[model samples]
Target: ILIGNLFTGNESMGNGGAIVVKSNSKPKIINNTIVNNHSLYGAGIWMSCSALNVVLQNNILWGNKASESGNQLYLRSTGSTYSIINNLLEGGVDSILFETPYSGILQDNYMFSPEFADYATGDLHLTCSSLAINAGSVPVVNMPLYDMDSNLRLNGSEYDLGAFEADAAATIVSQPQNMIVMNGDIATFTVVANGANVYQWEVSTDMASNWAAIVDDTIYSGATTSLLTVNSYAPMNGSLYRCIISGNCPQVTTISLPALLLVSNPDGFDENPIAVSVYPIPAYDFVNIIHAAGSRVIISDINGRIVADYAALSSDNEQISVSNLNNGVYFMKITSSNSTQIIRMIKD
Candidate 1:
């Protein structure tokens, strides 16, 4: 599926500067922006002598120039069939050249100029007043869930034509923040995004080397909602958490920054626990640990396996060599006389 893409800034001395589909190539071109190409013939696309089915839907073909022939599309095939639907063709019907006995379905297509945000700067995002809005047919198959800018498609009552979906308030307004929760307490992280978005909570022990989706289990609930709640436990200490926000459009996935979860045992801890910090989050060869001078540090993996142990000689910041370790999430447990704290660390 050729979906949710932009094809531009191309020039050819001959035909089909942007695309040329020859015989036996049954490609489905959907939700694409093809613009500003120059060629002798078929500046945008050319299909010649194909014996298979060619599908083109929800595409934007604009600002293409041809020297002497077809400006947008040139179809010259005797045995091929096509389905061209719900596309915004800026060029008129004369821009397309079809052979005799044109066997294709052409319905709900538009020929008006699609008012792009900035055609000169190649920013083809649709404005609110664009005619391409709500001018498309619903797809039967290969439907994209998101639009070009990771915005949810079908945000309106119907699908919009062209590559981008016009939305004024469809964006991630706020992201989840980091939190510190006591063991056995409830930890909640919330995100404030707009539009018809889908949310999935994920946890990674190793900075973000690998992420596992959070399901609606006993310990974790509200995994699919904007707010995610987790019943904190000792095992959940130092685990990194984040949310994945996406829409129905293809390739419209966004992962938020990792939030550190520090699970403290409040019952046995002193009034003031030792302050600690670790960096650089995604460490390559080594990671620096800043903590109390007499603290003892232990590094362990998510499986509770101890990887390294160190004793701080002085309060001076200590650096641990992690070049031999594989890239993944690990926890650094710093223990002092009064309290213990686990900090999440990642090896890159």
Candidate 2:
């Protein structure tokens, strides 16, 4: 029974690189570095006979034992009980696992990342995309809620898969300026960006930098190259409006004047039965097909799923029932024999 550390000088045994205890010894093995020791039996430190109750705290067990058995540390019916806590145990293939009918408690210990760092640094900071975030099977005696480096774990559902969690944060941006408009009473609006992009808008009353004022915003779903009458309840009041673009575009945002002057719509609309609001596209039940001044209609889904054949009826409105139909995702191919336009619709 002792209260101090004992530095063994038996490098000849080639097991206790730093300090190894073979016989039964009741010692407070605190804050020591056990390394670079190799052994034919227990490369790091081989223990047999005698009860070795150790208070292994802040100690390191690595690169020592390289025996045929456990390269790091080994215990073979040591007839000893060990309390290994807050220590670093790095093994080769078997890492840190013992099965000798000998049982002990292992906890608050870290065994991932660098798995091989300067023992003095104690910097177990793991990089993002680390596979060792939460991959341990054994539980510690008194598991430290935090890792060796004192970082919080499992902010979400469950714990990570290893020692480190790639503690990284993402950035979210809002309200980018990229619209063109004029000082008008009311007009059509079109939003455009360099690449195929999307946008949403917020209403503001002032044009000055002092934007203490705030207004509600509207979110647009899917993607549309052009939009008409882009007006919000809030008055433009000569205030510069903006269209924030997102998705697969440049990160740096851009702003433009309120879109009240110029206007634009989709190209090749004549292909569609103009004035004919094709309803329930990708329809199942009944689809209401509207037509222009003098027009007829034919429809088909992308996969050629269903084709509705109709005559050139001289009517402004027509109803095509498509009840007993399958359920899935499909696009609309509407045509008037003269011009054709493909409009995408979803099936319920």
Candidate 3:
């Protein structure tokens, strides 16, 4: 029985990085963190046993690499009796080898990053932002009293999905920043928070007065995850977006600040004869503009307020520092002797 263990950085030339169950063993692997292991097959675990009553539950298998396939797990026995439940697998079904007409119970598995606190130094502790917090199977019989870190196994009503349990409090790591995109372009907003929580992104068209829950449709995607993407159009301009994150075990909830979306140049910009380039969209600190010398440049916010202006450009490459600007949308207009070009900018 392998329980409350950490299996990491192991390598194998043939089968498994951590464990290679043969044709006869019945192993119970529960509540473990198996990560960063590599092998030719099944970088985390490889089980080919035809034995009965093999159990695997409440474990995390992530960030493992395999040369052939099954980077997390490989199941070679098609008729083995097994039980797999409530594990965080990185690649979902694709993480396992093929076994048709399987004889096992697989339930409540997740296919996302477990979000370890410090993966580089091999500290696999659960961070406040880990989805593994309070994500395990409920009513687990004969479970361990404490996790691998010696913390209480059940920090909340339910056990966490990994070998470590996080604290109950939920905190936002980074709020979703505003986006600026051209008409027909895609705009995305992402939020980073600490905890295993439910996420629901909402939109407010009436300037943060009334909000409506967004759904997966032709207009938007990932309304339920921390990241949201929108198929932007002119009508989505000035729309406010926010995410509602909630967690259990005291029921902590957080509502993020509403960020505005700006769609620039709904009618599209006129083409200029001379080639002008503005690069690194969704810029964080600095944005570069390259064009002909002696071109005049002007930058304005969504409200048509001039933020930065240059009377005449002396060089081909001009760097504009957007470090002080608030996260949102802006427009840049560059004019040469004969032609003028306007481009949309997003301060991410």
In order, what lDDT does every prediction score? 0.77, 0.43, 0.79
Write one digit per residue (lDDT tens) for candidate 2, span 1-348.
211122222343444344456666655554334555565656555555467565445444555555555555566556777776655566532554364765566666766433423335544343333333333333323334554335444322233333433243212233232333332334334555443254544333322222221233242222133243444222332233345443332232233333222211223333223444778665667766566324444444433434555556456676656664456443333445444433444556
Collision pairs in model 1:
145-248, 145-249, 146-248, 146-249, 206-329, 293-315
Q: 293-312, model 3: which lDDT tens digit per residue?
A: 79888877655578888899
The weakest ten consecutive residues by lDDT in model 1 span 246-255
- State the lDDT of candidate 1 residue by residue for 19-132, as single tens digits: 888878888888778999889888888888566668888888998888978889888876888888888786666668885568878776778988888988988887666777
Model 2, TM vs. native: 0.30
TM-score list, all predictions: 0.48, 0.30, 0.48
The reply for model 3, stretches above 4 Å from the true place, is: 99-101, 139-141, 167-348
Best by lDDT: 3
> Ten-residue segment with the worst summed lDDT in candidate 2?
257-266
